[model samples]
Target: MIRIIAVLMLLIPGLISAYGIKLMRDTLFNDFHPIFFHIGIQFFAGFLFFLGGVAFIGGFIVYRDKKKKKQREDN
Candidate 1:
């Protein structure tokens, strides 16, 4: 369903960040520039969050309009 797909899309960035952090910790460069890794993850996560929020809002607006149109057509 659309809702399920939307939820999964929103979860993608968190999953990516978790995997990225794990990979970074496992690598030899883990001790160096830790702040960079954290910052990069935060930036990506924030971007994804914003994108997901916009998509959700757009979907709601579309659904609302459709419902109103359907009601007017029935009347």
Candidate 2:
């Protein structure tokens, strides 16, 4: 259950990107700079990636601590 949730969490950004790309393709733009849009999207994606990395690291640390505590209790 946790593993499945973790996998879904990792895929979230890709799903968001796909949706954003579809929207961009369907919209008609006359004056907007494409580079600016690309940069903005990249920034948002980078932020999400950073957050996901933090969550992954935090989860690993918590899991490690729990396993260590269990081992100590067993001994």
- Cα shift from native, residue 31, model 2 (Å): 20
Model 1: which residue pairs collide? Answer: none
List the candidate 2 regions with Cα displacement exceeding 4 Å: 1-37, 70-75
RMSD of each: 8.8, 8.6
- Displacement of residue 20 (Cα, Å) in model 1 is 19
TM-score for model 1? 0.42
CA lDDT of every candidate: 0.57, 0.56
The parts of candidate 1 lying over 4 Å away from their true place are 1-37, 70-75
Give the per-residue lDDT digits (tens) of candidate 1, residues 1-75.
Answer: 998976786566556555555544544443444554575564554455555556665666577678788534443
Candidate 1 lDDT trough over 10 residues, lowest sum: 23-32
